[model samples]
Target: MKTRITLLALLTAWHAQGQTLTENSMADSKDIERIVVTGSRIVESIDEVPATITIINRQQIEKQLKVSPELQTILATLVPGLAPSTGTSSNSSQTLRGRSPLVMIDGVPQSTPLRNGALGIRTIDPNSIERIEVIKGATSIYGNGAAGGIINYITKKAHADSKFNGQVSLSSRFSTAKFEDSTGQRIEGMINGQLNNFSYVASASFEENGLQKDAEGDVIGLKYGLSDAVMHNYFTKFGYQFNDDISMQLVINHYQSEQDSNLVDVVGSVNSGEKTYAIKAPAGTDAPGEPQGPNNQNVMLKYTDQALFDNTQLVLDAYAQKVKNTFFYSPVLANPEQGYDGGQSVIKSDKKGLRATFNSLFEWDDLEATIIYGIDALNDVTSQPMVDGRVWVPEMDMENVAGFLQSKWLIQEDLIVKAGVRRENIDLAVQDYKTLRLCKSVDICSIPMAVKGDTLNYSATTYNVGVRYNIAEYFQPFANYSQGSDISDIGRLLRTATVSDIADIQTQASIIDNYEIGFTSVVDNLRMEFSAYRSTSELGTTNKYDPATGVYMPVRAPQEIYGYEALAHYQLADNFDITATYAWVEGKDTKNDIYLGAKQISAPKGSININWSPNELSSMSLTYLYVGNRKRFDTVAGEHVGDKGPINSYHLVNFSGQYQLNRDWQAFIGIENLFNQDYYPAKSQAYTYSGYNVKGLGTTVNLGVQYQF
Candidate 1:
């Protein structure tokens, strides 16, 4: 840390900076090859985009995988505005710029818009991904769930070098603080190759973890924990080129992760300043209903024609997905009169969709324009039910049709303009049902109500416009205004209904407006991008705490959220580089004049990475992350409640090294929490709910080796 600090200070004092420093759509010639297809839904250069986007290449993906297998940690370390990892299997409360971003895989939406479980982020394994593209800010290009933006995972394809090629890898992991029973193993293998007009790629991976302990050698809480977990993933892809003008591709992936621990929660109340931990269950204790986090599957097929017509391209996509996310057993689901102690529930969703697009290009003497038009149709069936044949949330069927048009113009190859419009028509149907009776205390229970269900209709037209100007070599600025149309957590609203008729319930749509302005700069050795944004919505979807029943009810109000993000990278030498990112966000209830809690927002975050490549055969990187404090609401009776607890800051340092032993062999190792800082994660510190105050992982190590055929 000191060496890099000294280098940066000396370089600044001597004014030795040179080259390029940029963070934004238009970076430099080095990144021109980075074609972004998310924000625009078509093949286009980054410079043509009038928004902030982050692209994570394959090399960067593999490097971060060595440090931590979890994609959550990797994304938080790299993406500035994304919330920190929750250190659990669940990604709840980890918002992107104070809102949930739509997660997708190769343009297939992975998020369940009606009932978001926040498990979409982990639906696919890292080995199956070639890259990740993030489009920041509100957008309706993809429709429905993209309230905050989009995160699209681009999958891998077959390599063209050989007819048949394969690789195998194995890894070992254990807690550095206490390795007695805290050990794990992972095995992965993949084969990919090209054969004339046909190409294919397939991979399989499995990992099992033992006990996970903290710095003080205590097992973390079993609720949403990773201890004693087993995960499996299978992925396959096939491609055929009928001709140069036409081609087809198919992709399928299945991922499953579940924990079957022999330990149980040693339950402690966060409100009373006690910490929650886990210990071995009693000898005669029985297991829960089922192991949590069952499985997710995705299948996609695509047909594309490069020369469908003169100066026009055509693409068609068909996709289907299934997800079963089983949650932990909770007393909040208990009903005394029903002779139930606690129950477990699972959120299951089956989704199918089709999309068609056409891109037409036109060029003139001093201007070039591209027009993209598309149509999308989707059907989603989702429900949440208790494992013991009890209905918590009835099944909901939703169908949607959307039409969109996007236009891009480049004037003199320096000034770019973009505009788009999307029209969404949706219908949701549900049968007559009764809300389940839930109890927080024996005497305090929620009354069940039988509600009449009917088909609900919603329609919206959203628009976006942006412009960018490359005025000079050192300054590139962009500004944008956009809107997102969404039906936020409709399933929750229906499940907790108090009225006898669904129509009487507040089923208002959430229309969010977002405005952003940012600039990128490149000067010698420094490249930087900074932006500021503000978002507002008349009908908010913030959750209101119901102390009587321990339920979070939907509350409507006006909300305003604003934030800033900055990304910078400096090259100290030809072989050494230092990159840094910082993000700060704040939100408020515009109607109530009170700041939002951790449930809706997170504290500021900053990260730094120092990379060194000593030679062609060896490389190493050290990463540092800092989460600042956020104190909003005060405690009641000297005890914090809900997510209103104050958050204390924490620091993390990680180390990763890779070396090529031979032409076909390579070794890698990573050390997480290198300093053994015994601290609670940001979510754990601010979430005062039971079983949520688990400590962050201690010093952990991952060592692995790979071999190629």
Candidate 2:
């Protein structure tokens, strides 16, 4: 209660002073006064939008350069509703506002839900991004699997005004004895040019990861185990001015990663025994561990604003992604008695998808209404090799199609109405296969005797509605009711078997319904927003895995969650600026007899962040975050189980700053977890209890130099 009052008072004082919050201040002046993309169909001021959206501009990214890695390292520090769980190895994933939100880069979907040790989240480098847009809460505008929210990474676009401009920067780091070559470096370069009616922008970046160790100089379990990887990112964009009334842009983005690690079998024994000894043999090694040798590529073609009608704008986007994994797996250690094999295995897959949108705005009855509609299609194929590098399962494919319609109505100068709906259709198909009894030594296995149906179909529809009103000058108050759906990628994979009929297969749909009220205020030298919300999803869709068929069944019930978020910025006098944000959330299953989603992770219940910049040449920040305890059915590897109530709240602080030594040279220093808080954000219990637990880095310090031209 005290915290709430203090925040309210601060907000009232700031707004009462008369400062206008500029909705599109983050963008350059020529871009647009107000713009809306993923949340609503119409282009409106951020203050007038019914949903909550956070925009991180280029300036913010520049400020964070002296901080930790932008991908998963500093998630909890910047975004309010997002918290990083275990993100070691390749399986690191984040929970948004307490739920999993889908991430997209230039509309290319990127997620690795089931793949063990998959580095899906580290596919992009921050240097290639121009702006980061986040829509908090359920999202139906993009269609399919936006139950929590959406994080869109917009890449840099070619500028027409610049005839030729280029930027280059080099950075390095200082390390302790924990890392063999504590020294590492990053190089980035970008160029933009415009000739006549054609304009283009291209950039490239290369960065290497440093090692982390414990106080004793020994490795700290799986914490940052795969932190020694290297990243390479390249982006290019070209825009053509067909005529005064029409123009189109094409963008292509690509990134490649090469990660090699020797921490295979790092899962030492908790109980001493011969069974605890690590396997020594190469192919027959039964060491319960995995090595890394993986890479991926993405290519996309986007045609923006192709003028079909004088007043209508259309955008067409298409892309394909291919990811390959060649790693070592020890199946014998998984099930000693029924060991399949122990050797190197490779899993390779390809995904392709396309989305197109049409937008139109016109005056009707002295009122302005903007309408947006679009369609999306996706297809994925998988092919895997056995432990001996022999082809096992033939190629399998899954496909999806969706269509959506959304609109924004400007009822009054200060009042706005928004609504939208989407329909998604999915199909899964597999090649004919027959199984026949054969000896285990045979490299090639017989195909299934019977052929399964060609296709399995699943369909669903989702919708949302909301309103925003400018109650006071520079103050916009809004209320919204939004809905979204979560369709399991694994659930759709089940229909490929020959035994099930498309009609009998039931599609599980998790529904998100949200109720929220918030206000955005801008005051001279101060900007802030405060919001409270209640969101719930029907429980029937909780993940329920069936052992008999090895399928995740959907359980229906009611799951409720509620929370609040507050953000504020204050610029005191000449150069002192401070930014802060606070957030909280609580989630529960209301109708489950037994805690079905017991081990389900919840969003953090409390968080605070403070950034201070005394001048352009120097800056620093401090942040605190707390992850509430959750109730689970059984204890997980010594970790408390049952109504665990709440895990002890942990607080962490990070510091960073930069100093300009000369006109073209600068230095940076950053420290993470200054107090060295020891805690775990994510853990799992498998086998005798084996899973990644993010061991907090006691205190890590890095210093680097940057030179620009």
Candidate 3:
């Protein structure tokens, strides 16, 4: 309690000092300029929004890419209140604000909510992205599957500096602990130009990853891992300016990643927390197949007209996407009736959508306001099937229509209020299918069951309201209330349904309500921000592993969650700057009165980053991250019974630097886990049911060179 009071007092004093500085040095100091588009459909200054928003510019993205090409790792280091990476292509245990956030490339959704593939974060390449925008808390601005927030990856745009311009780059990566057979390579090329009324940008890249090792010089297990893989990415964008008020653009992106592993998992003892291994299985053993990763293709077309009417704007967008993700082969049971020894399943999804929006400005008396209205239409089809063409989860089709209205009122020069509401209607149709059953022997067998198909309809209404007061150029305070809704594991429910009608399945959509209050201040060379939020759901979803079926089942219950975040940035000298951030979160299942595990509630975490620029030709950065202690369970009557017992604290350090040899040539190098810290990730430590705890990677280095023409 004393610590809390001291922190609050310091914050208040800082705000007062900032206000005084702004008043005295208004003409000398310049405020930072940042534009964002995720919180609202239109581009606006970040300070104008009544929410917590984080932006990663091109320079930051490139610097981080030099260290690691994994998007999950980059986001985990930068975004507050987000869980750490799972050291794989799948983000099974990572969550934003204690819930799943919708991942999007440009303006198109990449997540398969119906089946929950947990592969959306790896759908795009980091080299092709120009910027990333993250909005925190519940929001329904972009429609379904945003129960937590939104992550938007903006692609590169054409450069108008010259008629033709391009760059070529190459990099090599290797593990310092064990160098043999642990080397990887990457190559990338890009071109952009603008001629007359037409502009175009194109990029392509390929990467090869080798085996990973731990600090003890032991090869990490290959089961459901990301090492020993090949990745390919291609992206292109074209734009045409027909007139001053009219314009159109088209974008296309394709990405694929496949794994090649020659070993299988060897389970370890659960009581000792010993290391796991990957050993060569028997000759006839069923091993994982090649190309066991995500494959995605996305395309979009957009048109905008600014002169549709007086002081009015019109924008239209059409998009389509196809995604498929393959899982590792599992030898759960042997079945002779279906002519199959084991099962390998894949989840496939196809989506198409259209969005139309109109914005208008109005002025009456001493009041000024802007109104935005839009409509969304979409169709989605998803299914899961095995390698031998057997149905695991029947195909499901859905059609949705939605409309929304949002308005912002500038009541005074220093006060603004905003409100919005949306209505959604959806229809889903499914066909009759049969479930798979395997029998290792007559004593151990699963009975094949028949499932009936039906059509279901659902409707929901969501709303948001907020107010922001700008006290000065250096201080702003805001408060808001928002709502988000999403369908909960529709495919899983359908596959396990025993009734004939869809209504009798006992599954319903989840609606989450969020309330937040925050403040932002900028004074001289320092910037600070703090926010507190609470989110609740009348019917929450909980996942548990069923040992009998070897599958995870979802249960519904009431939930309550809350968290807080604080960030500070300061310029220590002319050539040095530092940033510090802290986040804390907690969640509880109200019905059962049991605290949620690490999967839902991440430990309190913090980070500090230092950047130094001795000259315009060279720069360096060093970062340190710390995850605090987390203990959610205790011994009950001499028996260990909670989710996973407890998890210990850990720390990591990383460094990267760049030197410009000349105007047209440059070199860079990066080191990860600089101290060779031996630790386990929270996901591995808390997952007791799996009986295998994976260790984090050891020290690694990457070196690269670039040539511009």
Candidate 4:
């Protein structure tokens, strides 16, 4: 209660004094000029969009890269409703708005819906990103797999002002608790130039990571952890301006990260209150083969024409992506005749797609109107197989064709109404495959039968409508209704199938409906936004443990989720600024009369950021993040046996600063967990009994230097 009151008072004070600030202040002018692309198919200013959207500009991205190059950490701090990072290479437990969101790079879909490898979010390196755009709530504007929202990672573009420009950066990271073998280094270089009507940009980076430790100077668990890895990234973009009204561009990116470790995990007993897990050197002399990370390659070709006709615009894009991810070796009882003790698994996905859009604008009397229409076509093939040539998940092929239309109407100078609809057709083909049946202690076991080859088809029509009223320069009220559709955990379903054909399996798509009401206020040097939303799905999907099979299976049930968010940014003085964000979310399974599991729902969270720039040569920032207490299930017989147990509140503080030494050189440093607080992550607490639980990172420091010419 006290924290809430303090935050409210701060906001109120800013609102009362904002009018006294200079009307032509540079900070105020910069706030309202930012443009975003994810809100709609076309680029529009932030104030023109009637939805909840957040933009992480280039300056913010650079600041975060100095600390950590991981996208998970950067987004967790910038976005309001996103879950915290798990200190691992996998993002299985992290969700957006209580659901999985579709991730994209330059408007090209990167998520493999057929067989989600959970590697989409880490496909591209942070150095290549120009900015990040997050569109909140359920939206289907860009096709399927957007039940929650969309995160678009826009890549860097060429610099047209210079004939040749280059930047070189080097960074070093080490653990502050114990610095022995916990040191990592990275080097990156980028060059951009423009000549005549053509422009090009190219970049390359290489990094090597070291061991990770906890607060107690103990080695953290290495099972699916982010330690001792090697990463490489290559990117290039080329563009040509055919004329004043026509343009063409091509983009290519290649990213690879692998984990190589000489140690194995030492399992700990959670029932006995033993939380520390250690790692020991392996016995065998076998080499730690290829690293356990994703190898991603992407290419895109885009063409745009502003004068297709008189008052019309056209955009066409074609893209292809290939991703392969490998997992660490796990204990799997295999037949001696196969000549293997244990095996590893790999998931490979290939996608190709084309998209085209047309926009037209016109005016009639006192009203201005605009129309947008587009078509998308895509084909995807994905498979999961063991290293020894055994199929864990058979190859699945999917094809999708979709079309959409949207219209916007402006009434005088106060109101704007927008409406849109989309239709999607999807076809999936699967082949017959056998399931793995491993026995314990050489005992005979009954193997589940394989599912036969079959074809499945599905179709859905999603719609959205919204209205925004510009009451005054300081306030704007809006209401929106949106819808989304997705196939929940298709990979899990296919890998654990016991049916003979596709018809016997439950492959129905889940449709989500979302309703939202919100308002935005821009008063001088202060900006604020608040929104409330409710989303429901008739056939929502949740995971349940199958004790008999020792696996998790997806179950369909009626589910509803509601949430609210508030954000404020105030310029306290000419050299100081503060920003605050808060989010509250709750979800329940209506059919079962129980709350959703932690994997599907996250607790309330808030963050505060302060920036101080006393002069132009140096700047500093401090950030505080808080996760509230959450308890969802009742104790039965003195045992906590439920999908979600109990979670305690935790907070963290971080500080970073940058200094410019001369015209050609600069230096920066970041200190994470400044106070060195020892606490378990919310996800780990929710899954305490699970073997996958692990502790969060302790105090760490990252310092870097850069040279530009």
| lDDT per model vs. reference | 0.84, 0.57, 0.78, 0.78
Off by over 4 Å in 1: 1-33
Instruction: Summarize candidate 3's per-residue lDDT along 1-709 as a digit string, tens digits.
Output: 2332233223222111211111222332222126565676765557668889888777778877888898988888888877887667877667888888889987689988888877888988998888888899988888878877898897876665456899998999889988977799999989988787777888999999887777776667665576678999999888777776677888899999987767677765334657675656678875555458889999988887765787667778899999989876655534667667776788899999999988776766556677889999999899988766778888989898999998877665567788999998888888877766765444555555676777788789999999888888588999999998788468877665545565677667788999999999999999999999999998777765454555455667888999999999999898899989999998999999978876677778898988899999999989898887778876455533324546788999989999999999999998888898887777666665443377778888999999898
lDDT tens per residue, model 1, 454-480: 999999999999999988758999999
Q: List candidate 4 stretches off by more than 4 Å.
A: 1-33, 269-271, 276-278, 283-290, 332-342, 438-446, 634-643, 688-690
- Model 2 Cα lDDT, one tens digit per residue, 1-709: 2332233223222111111112322234423323434465333456557878877666556555555554665445567766543435343335566556666776566653222233445666777776677788877676555556777776665454567877776776433435554455677888876788777778998877655443333344432344455767888777666664345556666676544444434454212111111112366443333444455677777555534575566667778877766554543212223344444455566878888877776666536676788888888776554544343344557687889998877764567888888887876665554322122233332222343435656676877888888776568888888887665343223322234343343434566887888888877878788888877877434454343433333455687777888888787756556667777666666785444232334434454555666667776666555655543445446543222323335566667777877777877777766666655443322112232332444466767776654
Cα-lDDT of candidate 1: 0.84
Ranking by lDDT: 1, 3, 4, 2
Q: How displaced is residue 256 in candidate 3, in Å?
A: 0.6
Residues 388-507, model 4: lDDT tens digits: 787888888889999999887767746888899999899988887776664322454326667787878989999999999988979899999999978746776777777778678887
Model 4 clashes, total count = 0
Per-model TM-score, in order, reads 0.95, 0.80, 0.91, 0.92
- Candidate 3: stretches off by over 4 Å: 1-33, 269-271, 280-286, 333-341, 364-366, 438-448, 498-501, 547-550, 634-645
lDDT for model 4, please: 0.78
RMSD of each: 7.2, 7.9, 7.3, 7.0
lDDT of 1 at 329: 85
> What local lDDT does model 4 show for residue 635?
61
